[model samples]
Each structure stands twice: as structure tokens, then as C-alpha cells.
Target: MENINEALGLLLVGLTTVFVILYLVGLIGNGVIYLTNRFVPEETMAKRKEIVKGKAKPTNPAKIAAVIAAVEAVTGGKGKIEKIDKIDKIEK
Candidate 1:
């Protein structure tokens, strides 16, 4: 009984230590990712320009009209007209 109790105590301590180490490693990894995301410079404009140029698509006026109509319908067609004008002006 004494030996069994001692072994169980050691096992619990070992498991606790492992759990703490794993938690600390996860914390440090997350901090690194956050810091890098905040401080790292984004892709250069040349790269961005190339990427955008590669994916050009013709504008679809009908889709734009449909979305505006949906917004007006959802907003009960009252304040929506002013809201639509605001959005159009902002886009311009």
C-alpha cells in the first residue's frame, strides 16, 4: 500500500509537469505568431499589382443592382434609399 501510494504521487507530479510544459510551449508559439503577424511587412506593391492584374474580371452591373435591391428590401425601402446613395458615394 505504501509503495502504491508513492508511485501514484510520482505519476501525478510527472503528469502535471508535462501538462505545464505543453501549455507553455503552446503559449510561446501563439505569441510568436501574433508578433510576426503584427510586425512583418506585407508583400510589396509590385507583387500585389501582379497578383491583382492576374485576376481581372469584367464588372457585372446586374449583380450590383440585385445586391442594392436586396439591401433596400431588407431595410423596408425607407431609410434604404439614402443608405444606398451613401454607399454609392463612398464607392466613388
Candidate 2:
């Protein structure tokens, strides 16, 4: 009876300690994020220049649109793609 009560008491204390620590960590993390977002200014990105090469094929606007659509769909319209670089095929 005494052993059982002691075990239950210890369990309760351990669980409460864990919950309180986790809650504090979450609060601190949220505070840090809020402070950074409030103080930091976002930078504007430069416009992409069209690349023209003698032998390279032209980039398709349709492909870029499709990729943007896919990303928006996956993020439920919250996803933002800053830049997308196309890899070139190389010959050995």
C-alpha cells in the first residue's frame, strides 16, 4: 500500500516536471520567433533575367507555371518559391 502510493507520487511528479519543461520550451521558442519576425525586415528579390544562348534550348514558361502550381497545391497556397534554377544536360 505504501509502496504503491510512493510509486504513484513519483510518477505524478515526473510527468508534471516533463510537461512543465516542455511547455516552457514551447513558450520560449514562440517568443524568439515572434521577436525575430517583428524586428526583421524582409528583403525584396531581384527580377530574373532571361538567359539566351547560341546552342541552349529556351526555357518554357509553362513548365515554370506548372511547378509553381504544384508547390502551391502542396502547401495549400502558402508555399513560395523564390528562385528555381534549371539544370543543364552535359556531355562526357
Candidate 3:
């Protein structure tokens, strides 16, 4: 009984020590991340948003020919493009 109690106590102590060490490591990591983000310059962290602005234009004949060729190749000449609609760009 004494040996069993001693083993249980050692197990509890080992688990508690590991938990405390892991908790401290997580806190330190979070603190480092917070400090780094707080001190970083905005220009260095700014990301560019690519915006394409253009009016709805007719599709080029060369592009249409290429699309028709690709579809024919994929479907063994069974596919056909009846109509092609131009998508207008939305301005934000």
C-alpha cells in the first residue's frame, strides 16, 4: 500500500510539472507574437489588392477559336459553343 501511494504521488508530480512547463511555453510564444505584430511597420505588412477595371468588350476571334478547339479536342468534336456571354467587372 505504501509503495502504491508513493508511485501515485510521483505520477501526479510528473504530470503537474509537464503541464506547468507547457503552459509557460504557450504564454511566452503568444507574448512574442503580440510584440512582433505591434512593432512591425504597416507599409511592410500591407498587401496589394489587384483590381481590374474595364467595360464589357467582345471576345476576340482568336480566343474563341482556341476555346472551340479545346472543347472539340476534349469531347471528340461532339461539343459546340452556341453563345458566349461577356462578364462585366463590378467596381468596388
Candidate 4:
């Protein structure tokens, strides 16, 4: 029937319009993100650099020395005990 064909055609057209609109929106959103990243970029690289450099400081020197001493004790003098620097605890 002519009415059935018209209804099917209109349904297909509506679906096609919705798909195109969604595709365009997604494309535009991605473009905006890319542009913003290019122009107004955050300091991800700088923060990463700082994080890499910040780990170089020794946190617990006493814990490290204790671990080393235990390893030497287990190894039975194969590992000579290095000179242990006394770490004074910081009284808060």
C-alpha cells in the first residue's frame, strides 16, 4: 500500500537524521577536546617531571639500614657490614 511505503520511508529518514546528528555531535566534541588540549593544555608533563624527581630523596634511613644489616646477617659475612650512619629520630 502507498500509505505503508510512505510510513516506512519516513521512519527510515528519521533514523538516518538521528544517526547523522549523533555522528556530527561526536565529531564536534572530539574536535573541541583536541583544540582545547592544543591551546589550553594542563601541565601533565611538568607534573610528571616533578614526580620523577621527587622520589630521589631518602624517606626512612633507619629502616634502610636495618634491612641492610639483616641481609648481611643472613649472608654470613659474605656481605661485609658497611659503616652504619646513626639516624637520630626527629622528636615532633
Question: For candidate 1, which ten residues in a row score worst on lDDT?
Answer: 81-90
Give the clashing pairs for model 1: none
Query: Candidate 3 local accuracy as lDDT?
Result: 0.68
Candidate 4: misplaced stretches above 4 Å?
43-92
What would the per-residue lDDT of candidate 2 be over residues 1-92, giving only the tens digit for each residue? 99999999999999999999999999999999998667765431111223322233335656767778889999999999866655233211
Rank order (by TM-score, best first): 1, 2, 3, 4
Candidate 3 weakest ten by summed lDDT: 47-56
Q: Return the TM-score for each candidate structure.
A: 0.47, 0.47, 0.47, 0.45
Task: Kindly indicate the candidate among 3 and 4 with the higher lDDT.
Answer: 4
Better of 2 and 3 by lDDT: 2
Q: What is candidate 4's lDDT per residue for 1-92, written digit by digit as tens?
A: 99999999999999999999999999999999898778864777566555456533345766666767777789985886444333234332
- Comparing candidate 2 with candidate 4, which one achieves the higher lDDT? 4
RMSD of each: 10.0, 12.8, 11.4, 11.2
Q: Write the per-residue lDDT of candidate 1 for residues 44-69, one digit (tens) a residue.
A: 54565554564432255565577677
**True-structure Cα RMSD, model 3:** 11.4
lDDT comparing candidate 1 with the true structure: 0.66
Q: How accurate is candidate 2 locally (lDDT)?
A: 0.69
Runs off by more than 4 Å, candidate 1: 44-92
